[model samples]
Target chain A: MALKHSVSGFLADRYDMETATGFLRKQAGKRLPPHTSWLHVFGSLSLLLFISQTITGIMLLIYYRPTPDEAHKSIQYITAEVNYGWLYRQIHAWGATLMILAVVLHMTRTYFFGAYKKPRELTWVSGVLIFIVTITFGFTGYLLPWNQIAFWATTVGTESANKIPIIGEWLRYFIRGGDVVTGETLSRFFVVHVIILPWALTGLIAVHLFLMRATNLATLEPVGEEKPIEPKHGIPFFPVHVCKESIVAVLLLAVLVTLSVLAPWEIGEPADPLVTPEHIKPEWYFLPSYQLLKYFEGPYGAFFGIVACSVPFLLLFLWPFLDRGKHRHPKKRPIAVGIGLVGLIGALVLGYLGHVSETEQTFFGTRYHIDHYGVPHRVADKSRDEGE
Target chain B: MSNRFLGNTEMNEPTPQPTRRSFLDWVIGLFSAVTVGAMTIPALAYFWPAAKGGKGGDVEVKEAANLKPGESAIVQLQGKAAIVRRDASGLVAYSAVCTHLGCLVKWDGARKEFLCPCHAAVFDASGRVVSGPAPAPLPAYKVKEVSGKVFVSTT
Candidate 1:
């Protein structure tokens, strides 16, 4: 219990709950939707991923600079300055991918499980928005390092935007802030990555959670049951679920740290407008787009690519209405669930394709053996000729 | 003389013993106890995570002599920035930090200077702030040779 002294007399607050038999008391004690299974862990994992990024990001920010000229050098200093600076960057880098993955999977799970049914539609929609924002965050962060791969990848991004016919050119200008990927682009991306997207997502998440509390976390009873179906599958959200999430999150962090320790992230060659990158690819999260670029032809390819990318959001936005089925079981609603699986697999395959060097196109065409993609690629053995 | 000695001494002075009395005294005593507890708890709690040291840094690059002559090395021994330098003497080590605004400096040997096209801050071999409005000089770390190995500080 907490005690507070009032102006006129002593006022006390009680932490204990009385076992009242009233209707309001019953509502207060009513258990939430029975999502006790591991299937629900991904949302918590997404939250954990965000926490990881924020922590790693703050640490990296101590070393990272926003200036176009000094940004890369500051990164080198972090690697060479304080201990484990590279680890900070690597963890955040990998954590961003994992964060995107976790949130996407969480949304997919919600869709497959029919958790987006009436009254919980906003939770699912906001979640989809969160996914898009996470990817946007990744895209903006990718260029902050300003390496060759980052440069060309962003070039691919901006140019792809320029293919949208009329608004395409304007949108590219809006995003890049001028003619091409220049100092303005870096500054603009910095703002979007560090401030804009995060602020927007934070508000969305708050509203999403409020709606979640209002909807009571959607229990696992039969959809049409009115007389209060069995509540045996339910569990308290705190000590039970939250505890598991903490453990899983710590373990995941440990694994990521080990990977970072074994192999730190490497910034490739500097961005040179004159020199073409040996072979460039986006961060793992954008493999699908890279693959899309490969499949499509010139300007039309970009337009089709944009349309392909935008379709998922449209589907996600309408998922609630489309999935108006009465069943929440895996046995039911096969089509929606199938779409989710195909999308996940498609993303994975595209990511795999992006990592392969043989099929990639590069100007010099000699970096095939340099840094293999897929996993986080770091610096190579340049002790003999680095800076030479 | 006795008063001076008494003022300095602890054994001679008489002190009052505790007595249960006024409500005001009791209230004052309670508030003081609460205040102390509040101050101590938060202070200790704040230090706990810091003490555990979740904050990690980079490994320091070792030895100015590891690379023979003008040989450059790309180091990913920690995580983010790669330390690329052909520095044979501790005289210089360029931060792979991009000069455009300190991303991660990369060396352009054909160009013979550090280039950060993000805003195009370039630095010469001396690690001096060569071109581009790099507000500060490239940091030169103190490294010594020990058993033929280079170590960078990542604390």
Candidate 2:
């Protein structure tokens, strides 16, 4: 715990005070890489966003009731009575989206730079779990508002869960609290969103920091025999990097605050167990799954769902082993980078398809472009049939 | 500052480096266990507690004419459907049967309390706790008067 080094007494006697200060200063400078620039701000920005979520989440919990009978009412009270409560909710919602985006970008940067290699597989996979939890956080939190949209969206979730082979019924039964989205379901989701997920994320973050303390930051691998010059491109973690992180945090907070101010929050109709909502869509993240649900039928569709779910886990668990090639320069490992990019693009496309109305289902899935010349010749007929 | 340079350049220096280690790998390992834990904690808590009940409360019923003075009715609420009664002056509502171990509450015309002799969950005219462990008061119903007849709301 002492700040003093083990050999402090020996060094102090050997060198004059000024010379010793100079010697320590030289060593500290050598420890940092010169390329330590501002682009690294994203990670700090992410940390700051999460802190915002924690604060806003706690504040919202003070007013937002979790029971189905009262959840919607509590949200309304917060929006109308608690000054800035509306803003806080909006910030939490949209800030979550932004956090996911930031995380993805961070991961992409790491992947492209080959940050998931030896001694770093743990970090990469942890990041992947965080991604999964972040999305889950969005889903579980979505239904707490008790809006018609949230209610129906979660209905889709329950229905989807029911489609799973063995324990589907039990799973859906538990999630909806006795086969229906009632007060019990609302309370269950509240406990998950507020208490459970955050606790998990906090532990992951701690291990994430601990691991960083153990393994050196993965620098860009030497490009084509041009090895990274010594005294790599980084600064000491103390004043230089900490100062920058704090500034980045401030800027991120500024942006989030501005967005929260501009877009106030709102709650929809109080959930009535008797009324069935018209639109049944899950959270934005689940859009891909919801979209996939349309493409597969019976068992095959179920298998595809399983595959989609497993891919993230597979990549997270086996990434260190999968991309074990020595080349850390992204351009050199085009296959891995391309694979990651393709997966991302597919996810985005699927998410988009999930939101767009799917009137008709086909083996080819929803409508796709034949070079996308406005519309395909048979497309109008297909859509017409779907409408009918 | 811009995209001109690539790779892990410090956009914002996090802190002074005592050592040059990256924390990411540890985070990855931690994520797997934490994910499982996050899911399990809420789920275990769910099955532990019993399910909650609905709202709808109890009601009251008065007597037509007890032909006595200064006496009260012993009412029942939340047991064996719904029932009520009336003493000399005030109204009391209770189930004709008793709650404790399913005995019966005998209306004591002498003392004016619905006395469950089996468990002794004694109740006053209101069927409220005059004594003993009846987790709740007896289920009660309402009373109203017609043109010539006084009718009680049953069930």
Candidate 3:
């Protein structure tokens, strides 16, 4: 204690430690709105997942080779040979899915609570951009595994850019760093996934947090309304809100650990550009868009498909400006609630279709084959047909 | 010393030359632009796909005499998959990449066609799309028979 005091005193004499420390103390002890709920924990949970990803990603980089020839080999080496590498890899893989889930859930909660209003508009905009960055993180990271699914999925994913009129072809080439996905593409994705995205996300998250702090959490009160938080009356951020967040974090970690252990991610066959896997589907988060794109066909299909995929993001980014209403409660906003429900249901249905596309399934007594466009056709009953 | 300093200052102070300040600003701006361009140009160029990536000469598949009629061989040409088939007419070579989604196609001797396992896209012996979701046929490559050996041009 004496040594600690002396060191602190020495530093205090040289620097304005008192004010800096006091500011942090004040922030910690700040009173949160009385209406703060457990649902508010998702944003912090998303941050926790990002931290986990960063740690595991660094661990992975130790052994990961970005070259096409060695990328798969390196993954195999990490999974099979490196000490606790499998654990890190599994956590990183599972963390990405959970991070996206947490971000979506957080956004959903914010939307329902009508938090993205007036002072919180910039917060919502930053959050949406962060979501986009998070998705790019997933897309770029997916290819690092260098598996057949990654290869073909990337091929399909990048090919969507080919519909963009004048810039379409160049965009595809730029993305791939070539006419097709190759070693160059792997290198580009590696640099992007590892370096570019991490910095981008970190910067965006800082902006988002700064805005959140500046604006304060939106309450159930109407838009543009303010409730002065009384320190004694409101919940203290340090102990009360922190405790709730800790509990959620612990639960989320447990889920992540359980997932990592039980169903560890598999290192599939090395990417062979020549041979494509039979069922090449992207990660579940992209399924909705993937399935949506399949509905468009013919000369104008690509252009329209690009537009259709972009509509949701565009709407989401500008939602605050579009919905300039005073009411914060969903009960007061019937149309907004209805539209949200429709979008949610539509995405869920589309994701299901994407998952079940190009597969054979049995419904009741009949076997049906789901085709490329996710349309099901009844297969002839072999036994009955043969007997007849 | 004060008198001389004042005299020097008076001599230096001409009509406030706004052009000098503007010229200095322009110089700084030009220098900044040059510095940025020096970095930006190389960075932008770095992203462009290299002119040469895999070896671009003829890739020898095998001896022409060894590959029997009704048989096919899958080989790497210019680091891309290419299919070579031997028939009674001669040897024919085509890019193995499927037009539907860039999956490699397999030669099915039984079906006398190139079959893409993904999406079940099929291409006939002549590299024309036979069925399935493939919008275009497999691209054909030039095949040359030199003495007893067969070579596929991957340029």
Strongest candidate by TM-score: 3
Q: What root-mean-square deviation over C-alphas does model 3 reach?
A: 5.2
How do the residues A191-271 of candidate 1 rate in per-residue lDDT, one tens digit apiece?
A: 888888878878877887778767766654435542342446456565666677778888888978987888777977667
Docking class of 2: incorrect
Off by over 4 Å in 1: A1-35, A221-233, A357-388, B1-155
TM-scores for all candidates: the values are 0.61, 0.60, 0.88
Q: What is the per-residue lDDT of model 1 for residues B4-66, given as tens digits with 9 covering 90 to 100?
A: 322333454576333344445667779999999999999865422222221334355553335
Which numbered prediction scores highest in DockQ against the true structure?
3
Per-residue lDDT of model 2, residues A264-366, tens digit only: 5456776543333333456666766666544443334544665666676687678878776888777788898888888888888877666653233333554
Error of 3 at A312 (Å): 1.7
Winner on TM-score between 2 and 3 is 3
Rank candidates, lDDT, best first.
3, 1, 2
Give the lDDT of residue B107 in candidate 1.
Answer: 69
Chain B vs. true chain B: TM-score per candidate: 0.48, 0.42, 0.75
The clash numbers for all candidates, in the given order, read: 66, 51, 1
Which of the two, 1 or 3, has more TM-score? 3
Candidate 1 vs 2: which has more TM-score: 1
After the best TM-score superposition of candidate 2, give how far the Cα of residue A155 lies from its true spot, in angstroms. Answer: 1.8
Candidate 1 displacement at residue B123 in angstroms: 36
Q: Each candidate's DockQ score against the native complex? A: 0.01, 0.01, 0.33
